[model samples]
Target: MDVKRIVLLISLALVSYLMVLQWNQDYHSPAPSVATSAPAPSVTTASSNAVEDERLHLGEAPTPAAQAASPQALIQVTTDVLDLRINPRGGDITYAALLQHKQRANTPDQPFVLLQQDNQRTYIVQSALEGLANRGRIQFQASQSQYQLQEGQDSLQLDLAATIDGIPVVKRFVFQRDSYEVKVSYLLDNTSAQALETRFIGLIKRDNSVDPSQGEALGMSAFLGAAFSSEENHYEKLEFDELRERRYLSEVQGGWVAMIQHYFVSAWIPDAQQTNLYSTRTDNQGRNIIGFKGAAQRIEAGQQAEISANLYLGPKIQSRLEAAAPYLELTVDFGWLWFIAQPLFWLLDLLHDFLGNWGWAIIVLTLLIKLAFFQLSATAYRSMANMRKVGPKLQQLKEQYGDDRQKMSQAMMELYRKEKINPMGGCLPILVQMPVFIALYWMLMESVELRHAPFMLWIDDLSMKDPYFVLPILMGASMFVQQLLNPTPPDPMQAKIMKMLPIIFTFFFLWFPSGLVLYWVVNNVLSIAQQWVITRQIEQQGTS
Candidate 1:
C-alpha cells in the first residue's frame, strides 16, 4: 500500500462514517407508510399521576369516569393552509394536516397529515387551564361540528365552551387564511362570587414513531424529538430515548417548546412577556410530552379575561418559523456546519426564486461554488498533473529501491522536490473544501423546499431517489474519468483498490435523493474536465 494514500483514504472514511453515524442517531426507523384512509382520533391524555409528579402547578382533580368514557365530539376546521380536528373533551388538536403539502408526491389530493391519533401513531396537541379540576375532561360544546373559512374571509375562529367548577370557560382556536400559527386562547367568564385564578398550559404529546414526512433514501436523516428555547439557551434538543431517561425542566420568559420531525414541526409558543415553566415527560401510554405553562392570572368576579398562546404546525420554512418564535428556525437543523449551510441555502433559495426550479437552482449553486473556489481547485489540479508527469520516474525509483523503504521514500521526495511539486498539494486543497461539501450535503438533506421538487425528464421528486438510476451511473462514470486523469498508484494493491472506488461509490449513491445525486454528478464532471485539461497541458510540456 502507498502509505500516504492509505492514510488519506482512511481519514476520509473515518470522517464520513462519523458524520453518517451521527445523522443516523438523530433519526429513528423509517416511518410506516401513510394510511390510505385516515383513522378516528384517539381519546388520550396525560396521566394524572405523571402530572402530579411533574408539579406543573396544574391544581387539577382526577378526570371523571363518565366524562372520560363518553365519546368526545371532534370539531373539524378548514382554512386555506390548515385542515384539523379539535376534540371538545380537552379542546385538544387531535389531528392536523397541511392543505398545501401532500402526503406523497404522486398523491396530489391527499394532504400531508402532521398530527394524528390512531393505531399507527399518536401525536396530538393539548391546551387547558392549570387551576380547573376538570380541565382535561371538560366536554366543551361547539356551535357547529364543522367550520370553514368563507371565500373572502381572511381568518376563522372556532370556540368550544364548557363550565369548569361553575366558571364559564371558552377555548377558542384562531386560524388565518395563509398562516400556520393557530392562536389558542381561553376566555374566562368569572360570574361566580369568587375570583378565578388559572394558568394556561399547552403541550404536544407524541409516540416514538418514525418521521412520516422523511423520504426513504440512503442519506443523512433529520433529527426527530423535542426542541425548545429557554432564557439560558437559545435552543435545546432531546431525543425520545433521552427524554425517557430523565426529565427536562426549564424556566424562562417567552420561550417555546416543539415536537420536530423531518420537514414539519409543531410548537407551542407561550406568552413572551411573562415567565413560564417548560418541561418534558412521558405520559402513561409512553408518549413523550413537552409543554409550558404561563404565569398565573386572576380574574376578579364579574370580569372576563383571555389567556392565549400560539400553536405553529407546519413546514420548517425559515421565514414562518422566525415569525412564529425566536430560535424556532433552529429546528431546521444543518449540523455543526450551519454557518456554511445557512449561506448556501440562502443562495439556493435565491436562485430558486429566479429559476422557479430546485434542480436548476442546485446546479447553479454548484457552479457558483466551483467558481468561488476556482483558484484553489486549479492549484490542486496542477499538482495532480505534475504527479502524473512524474509517474514513470517514481515507478523506476520504487523498482531501484525494492525492499528498501527508507531509500524509496528519499528518492520519491527528491524527485518531487526536483520537479517543484508538493506530494500533498492536491490533497490539502481538497481537504480544505470538505467542510463546504459536507455542509452542502446537510443543507440539501434538510431543506423541505426541495421535498417534492422535480428536475427535467425521468426525475419527478428531487427529494426521492432517481427511479431510473441514471444520475448515479453518470456520477460513477465521471468519477472514473477524473481518476484516469490523475497519477495511478505504483503499488498493485493500492491501484486495484483505487480502481474499485467509483463502483463502490456508485452503489452507495443508488438510493440517495436525485437532487443530491445531481449535484454530485455535476461536480464530478466539472472536476474531470478541469483535471483533463491540466493533465494534457503537462503531458504536452513534458514531450516538448
Candidate 2:
C-alpha cells in the first residue's frame, strides 16, 4: 500500500470512530424526567443560618419565609430581536423567543423559543441575594406587565421592587433595541442600623429537555449541556450525567456559565472585576442549576450597594458573544481544529459580505483556496502525469518478474530512479491540504448564520442536506472525473479500491449539509481542470 492509501484509510478509521462515539452519546436511553416544580424562595434573616463564606452547595434547600406574599404577575418585555416574559416571583425569565431566528426554514413566521418554563421543559434564569433572601423566589412587584421599545427609543428598562426585612431591594432588567444581552442589577437600600452582609448569586436552571433540532438530521446531534470557563480551564463542558455524579466547582475573578444547545445559548455572566465561586448542582426537583456566587459584600447602615450581571439569550453568533464577555466566542466550538477552522470561517464570512449569497460565497472561498495551493497541486499533477507515461513499462516489468516479489520491487525502484520521479510527491501535497478541507467541513457544519440561508434554486437551507441530492450527485461525478485523470496504481487491488472511492464518498456526502457538498463539488471541478491542463502540457512536451 502507498502512503496515499494509508493516509486515506487512517482518516476513514478516525471518522468511523467519531461517528460511533456520537451515536452512543445521542442514542442512549433517555433519563427519567425530573420533577419541574419551582423551589420556594429562601429567606436569610438575622437569626437564620450563617451563609458559607464562598461556597454554594446544591443540596442545601434554604428555609422558606413564613409570611407568604401574594402571587406576582408575569411581565412581558419586547425588543427588536427578542421577546421575553419575566415572572415577578423570583424575577426569573420564564420565556425568551428570538425573533430573527425561525423554528423552521419554510415557516418564517414562527420564531425560535430558547428558554421556556413549562410542564414539558423547564429552563429559566434565576438570581437572588444569598444571605438576605432568595431574590429569585421573592415576590417582587413590577410597575407594568408589558414593556416595549417605543419608536426612537434605543433602550427600555423593566424594574421589579420588593422590601425584604425593611430593606428595599430593586431588580432591574435593561434591554436594548438591537442587542440580545440583558443587564440585570440588584439595588439594595440598607436602612437598618446594623451592617448587612450578602452575596449575589445568578444561576440557570434547566431540565434535560430534548433538542428540537435533533430529529432534523439523521446520525447528527448538537451539544446540549452546561459549559463554563474559569481561570484554571478556559472552557469546560459538564454533561448531565457528570453533574449527577459530582459537582463542578471553581473560583475565578470573571467567567461565565451557560446552557448551550445546537443553535442557541443562554448564559449568566457575572461582574468581571469580582472574584466569584462557580458550581453546578441538581435541585431536589431534578432541575440542573449552574450558578456563580459573588464574594460577600458588607453594607454599612444607611448605605446602598448594587450588584450587576449580564445575561445573554440568543443565537450563537460568534462576534456578538465575543463582544459580550471574555472567551465567550469559544461557545461556537469547532473541536480540535479551531485554529484553522476559525480563519476559514472568517474568510467565508468576508466572502458572504461581498457576494451577498452564501452559496456563491462558498464557491468563491473554494476558488481562493485552490488558487493558494495551485503550485503544490501542479507539482502533484506533474508527478502523476509522469507515472501515467511509465504505466506500460511498469506493467511489462510486473509480467517479466511474475512470482518473484523481490525482483518486481527492484525493477520498480530502478524504473522510478531512472525517470527521476518521486512516488510520494503527489501524496504529500494532498496530505498537506486535507486539514484545510476538514476545517472547512466543520466551519460549515457549526455556522448558524447558514441555518436558513438560501442558495439559488432548489437549495433553500444551506445548513441542511439537499432535498434533491443534486449537489452530492454532481460532486460524485466530479470526483470520478478527477480520479480518471490521475495515474492508476500498478496493483490491481489498489486501483479497484481507488475506483470505488467516488461512489462511497458520494453516498457519504448525501447526508452532509448542502453547503458542504457544494464546496466539495466546486473544489473537485477546479482540481479536474487544473490536473487536465497540467497533464496536457506534460504530454505535449513528451511528444515534442
Candidate 3:
C-alpha cells in the first residue's frame, strides 16, 4: 500500500473501535444524535461565597437516589439538588447490593428502606430530596425544619435520629454537593456502656425500569441462577404490560463495577478486601434474583466504624475518570490502538485552541503535520523522481534481459547503486507518523466536544460525514492527483490496483466524520503540491 492509503486504513479501523467502546460504556453517542440534552446543573454545594464562582465542597452534595428522570428513556430525577439515575431496560443491576433508603424532610429524621437498583447513575441533592419527597418516611415520624440553602455555603450539616428498636439512633450524613462525596458520621449514643456491634453499609443503587421480564438492554451484565432463564437480545421499548429491568444484586462479591447505559458506573468495595458480595434483582413480580443471600458482615461494639465513598456522576470525561481511579477509566475499552486514542485527544485539544473550530482545527493541524514531515515526503518524492529519471535506461535494460528475473533484479540493483538511490527512502517517515495519524482519527470519533460541531458551509457536524459528501469527493480528487504523480511500478497489475486506491479510499472516507476527512484532504493536497515541486526540481537536475 502507498503511505497515505495505509494511514487511512489504520485511522478508519481505530476510529470504529473507539466508537464501539464508548457506546458500550455509554461515555458518548457517536454523532450527538440527541441535541436537546441540557448541561446538568452543578451537582455540588455552594462553598465559594462569590456568586459567579460556582464552588461546591465535598460535604455539600446529595446522594445518588434522590432524583427521577427518563431520557426518552434516560432516567433522571432531581429532588431539591439530588440527581437520581435509572438503569435502562436490559441493563445490569442488583437489588441486594443497592444503597436504598427513605427519609422525611423535617427535624432531621433518618431514611427508611428506599429501594435501589444496580449500576444506576442517579444522584441525590440533600436539600432537594428533603423538599421534593417532602418526608420520604415509612412507619416513622419524619419532618424537616430550619432548612436554609445559603447561596455560598460549602455544606449543609444536619442531625438525623432514626428510631430503630424503640430507641433513637442518632447519626450525621454530611452531604457535599460539589464533590458528590457524602460523609457519614455516627454518634454511638447507645448508652449500653458495655459495647454494641452493628453494620453501617452506605446505600446507592440504580432504579427499576418499566420492563420487568428481561431487565435493562444489551451489553449489560447480569447473572441468572441455575433455574433462571437466559435473557439475551430481548429488550424492546413499549411493551404490552411492563418492561423488565434488573432490580438489584442481592450481594456483590470479589470486585464489583456497575455499568449504566452511556452514563456512569461505580465499583463497590467492602473494606478493600477480597470478600464476596451478593446480588439480586427486583422484577415486576418483585421476585428477588438473589445471586448471593445472607452474606456475612461484622461490626464492633462500643467503638464506632464509619463508611465513606466518592461518587462520580458527570459526563464520562476520560481525564476526570483517570483522576477518579486507574483501571477505573479503562472500563471504557478503547481497542488495541488505545495508545493512539489517548494522545489523539491531547493533540486535538492543542489544535482546537489555535483554530477555534475543531473541524478547521483538524484541517490546519493535519496540514502542519504533513508539512513537518515534508523532509521525509520530499525524500519519498525524490526516490520516485530519481526512479522516473532512470526510467528510459531501466526499460532499455529490461528489454536486453527480457524474460529473465535474475538479470532484471541484478540490473535494477546495479542501477540503484550507480544512481545512489535508496529503495526504501520513504519507509521511516511513513511508519513513524502512522500511529499519530491513526490516533488523531480515533480522537475525533471519541471526543464529545466534536459531537455536533460544524465545519464550513454545507457541513454542519464535524463528527459526522458531510451531509452532501462534498468533502469526500474533493478528498478523493486530491488523492487521485497525488496518485497520478506517484512513481509507476513496473508491474502492470500492481499499477492498476494502485490506480484504483483513490476511489476505494473515497468510499471509505464517505462514512467517516468530517473532521477526519478534512485531515485527509489537506494531507493529500500538500503531498500533491510538494510532488509538483519535487518533480520539477528533479527534471531540472536531470536536464542539467
Ranking by lDDT: 1, 2, 3
RMSD of each predicted structure: 5.4, 5.0, 14.4
Whole-model alpha-carbon lDDT for candidate 1: 0.82
Cα shift from native, residue 538, model 1 (Å): 1.8
**Candidate 1: misplaced stretches above 4 Å?**
1-3, 14-72, 133-136
Q: Give the higher-lDDT candidate: 1 or 3.
A: 1
Against the true structure, candidate 2 has what lDDT? 0.80
TM-score of predicted structure 3: 0.57
Pairs of residues clashing in candidate 1 = none
lDDT of 1 at 298: 90
TM-score of each: 0.91, 0.89, 0.57
For candidate 2, write residues 482-512 as lDDT tens digits. Answer: 8888888888778897798788777766767
Error of 2 at 9 (Å): 2.5
Poorly placed runs, candidate 2 (over 4 Å) = 1-4, 12-73, 134-136, 213-215, 218-221
Best-first order by TM-score: 1, 2, 3
Expressed as tens digits, the lDDT of each residue in 1-544 for candidate 1 is 2546866686559555844643454454544332222222221223333344343533343332321222346788999999988877778787899998989889999999999887678898887787673344567899999999989999998988888778888888889989999999999999899887878888788888887887677387578899989766888988887776677766668989999999999999998998777777665455677888788899999999999999999999998999999899999999999999999999999999999999999999999999888889999999989998999898898889998988888888888889999878887788888899889988998998888888999898998888989998998898898888888887777788779878977876777889999999988888887778888888899999
Q: TM-score: which candidate is best?
A: 1
